[model samples]
Target: MDRRTLLTSSLAGMAAAAASAPETRAQAGGSGPPPFAETMAEMTWQEADAAAKSGASVLWAFGVIEQHGPHLPLGTDVYIPSAVLRRARQILAERGHQAVILPAFYWGINQVSGAFPGSVEVQPATMIALMADVLSSVKKQGFARVFCTSGHGDALHNKTIFDGVTAGRAASGIDAAVLFNAPLVKRLGLDTASPAVLGFEVAESPARFIDVHAGDPETSAMLHIHPELVRKDLLPTLKSTDYGPADLAEWRKGQEAARAKTPLGYFGDPASADASRGAARLEGQAKAMAEVILARVGGK
Candidate 1:
């Protein structure tokens, strides 16, 4: 048999066995937004085999450790998306699809934010190669259906991710779908989908006034997902700074230009952030993504 055919056949038998056998820790009863049920990092090889056998659609997320002004943690990107995907998994399970969360790919290319302190970034090419290799690994592990999600939103960063997906699918022949928020994807204007590299889109938040980095949406998201990580005290003094088209063009001229435009490393109005809005943003984004994944993959 060819690779996909062989893997599918093996899963059919293993799934039957898994269904008849006792539930592993992954299937144990839980409540209230619990941790990932089946993670590659946490599962034993035997348990992972059972997960593979269960035909769970594998999921992985991408983020970066970087400055988000002075109020949010460097891990703001990682925490928010991980929370969103955790909720997405719950929504998927409710719709009768088993999705296993893989450990997140947190290290990422940080171009716009590279000028800031604590911004650990890799070259764009490095990110692209890593994406290709990671997806290839997933395909080799017999996970035929997979999804990639990202929390970071830089146009260049996302492009590298998209290219990596292309290279990975070309190299390994897995049917993987990547998802991103619609506005940023539209802004990037990337031809983001193909048969081999399917992707879905969701709105990152409700309509915002003057939306930009480390602003209301992002700050509120961190407040909702990781409240302790937010510097609530500093929020009161940070003023609103909007970067219009011309302003952004000027800002991107160089790192010094960007830093000069936004001295404290933030843009938009952060003092206006609200945790209630944050909760709603999380629910909206997570639900939109979950619904699409169910429609696209259908428990495959």
Candidate 2:
């Protein structure tokens, strides 16, 4: 059998074995632990306090609602971060670490898609304020180690979010840290070059699907994560413009180059994306993120 088929079969067998194994307590048998979903929801004030008392780290997924070419949904940024956080939590639990992911922040600065339909753009200050409040709330609950992760590629926006988190940490006197996964992906030696674009990889991986703007990667990820949200047959074929942050002032020049670029707001080839590759990438990202948390919070 091919590598994909073999890997899938092996994973299935391992899952079957795990399912058949008797449940074990965290303190006694040291085997199975509570599933991540049980801890990631919006908890009551008292619940948050109790979790904080347990000294667990809080991971917040920062996302945005922006236009992703013509094929991908506006909430692609939001969903991708959430997926990464969930996967990270699973990995942490397996390693006997107490970490819980929080809901994502969907509003962010979106200059590229500001003109697109259904795209919601927030002021940089507004994003900073909102994130500060969210982190403050988490801090109030006694979570000393606050971790935030963003999937959005806007470097400035992410910096603002991190800055806000820093303000919250200082104001609340809580030991908190924010992580930007796009940068982390690069630090982990992942080939995020033009061909092996991280964004495209995120969409196609098993944990999600490869739906480039609504093409393959992003569409495939949506298919795997929330298949009902995808309008697969209604794929669009409009060309997208290529305008990076550096080309903001020279609009005419950028637009001219954009005309010759790919139709979808995507980089790299999405045709090669598959569920197995997506799953593996997700796992790698989660592991790298967890290590960052551990290092920051005194994990051995």
TM-scores across all candidates? 0.82, 0.66
Clash numbers, per candidate: 0, 23
Model 1, span 168-286: residue lDDT tens: 88889987766876665677675555653344554554544456778898998877876766778889999888557777776556466778888888877889999999989888888
For this target, which candidate reaches the highest lDDT against the unseen true structure? 1
Over 1-300, each residue of candidate 2 has an lDDT whose tens digit, in order, gives: 999999999999999998888442322332222223444565676777777888888888777887665445577777666777787887777776787677677788665445555667788888777767877877777777777777666555566666677677667776656664564445434443422122212222232322223344454454455444444443434322333444333321322342234334553333433455455656666777887666666675
* Predicted model with the maximum TM-score: 1
The per-residue C-alpha lDDT of model 2 at residue 177 equals 62
Candidate 1 residue-wise lDDT at 146: 75
Global Cα RMSD, each model: 15.1, 15.9
| Candidate 2 local Cα displacement, residue 150, angstroms | 0.8
